[model samples]
Target: MNTLNQGSQKYDVAYLKQTIIPGKTTKGQITQMFGAPTNEELNSTSTSNESNWTYEKTDEGLDKYMKLAHKYVSTETSLKMYETSAQLAKAQTVANDVSSVTGTKTGQSQTQGSVLTIYFVDDVVKYYRVY
Candidate 1:
């Protein structure tokens, strides 16, 4: 399967909520449930080394139609579609502006993905955050 497609896979959020307990859950269980983390970090503290594991899922597709629409459509029309003027302006800028450094148009639509991060100290879960 294409791991690149975030919407293609299903994650058990409820199960994660029930299982991930700070100070109780171990790194092994986390690895078993979610497979290997996408990223890992080592943090140094006064006492010992701490570890952070991040599991991320992203869904990205080229928004060709939106790009085309933005290029052809008027600002007034784009404003109606966007929620705010700032958003419209940013969209237009991204779609149209050529980067002075890269010399490439920098417009693309990307939906932010969900991230699960577990912080570990002494081989046990110290804290976790989901965003």
Candidate 2:
């Protein structure tokens, strides 16, 4: 399978939620754990010196389609390699099932990911959210 990255890093949201605590975790500590952010920006709309750091991972192309194609091809090939009637019958059944499933259409969602953003102020985490 292929992977597409929209930013500099990827993150396990569950781990982040459990580890990173607002008003507790320091910016230095966050960097030590998750590495550099995809972007660093000051929250212009806010009067305080609040900053936002973003970490994002996005979908890869053709992964779903390739998996479906591989399933169908492998099942059909197994039908030819089987020497016994029972094996062949099983292979045929598998092949039939695989054949009926269609690949994803264009513009269909292949995978899903959420951007993990940490908001900081005074070099400490103020709050965090996934967008």
Q: Which candidate number has the best lDDT?
A: 1
Task: Please provide, for model 1 over 1-131, each residue's C-alpha lDDT reduced to its tens digit, 9 standing for 90 to 100.
Answer: 35434331213445455778888999998877677777998887537668999876541322334445667779988766555646877876766544534656322222222677789997899987765
Model 1 lDDT, residue 23, Cα: 88
| Best of the candidates, TM-score | 1
Residue 68 lDDT (model 1)? 57
lDDT of 2 by residue, 1-131 (tens): 23423222234545556788889999899888767776898977777788988765432233334434456767766455444546866886776566556542322121223677889997789988765
- Alpha-carbon TM-score of each model against the true structure: 0.48, 0.48
lDDT of each: 0.64, 0.63
* Counted clashes in each candidate structure: 0, 0
- Model 1 Cα displacement at 79 (Å)? 23
Q: On a 0 to 1 TM-score scale, where does candidate 1 land against the true structure?
A: 0.48
For candidate 2, the per-residue lDDT at 81 reads 42
- Quality of model 2 by C-alpha lDDT: 0.63
What are the runs in model 1 whose C-alpha is more than 4 Å off?
1-13, 59-113
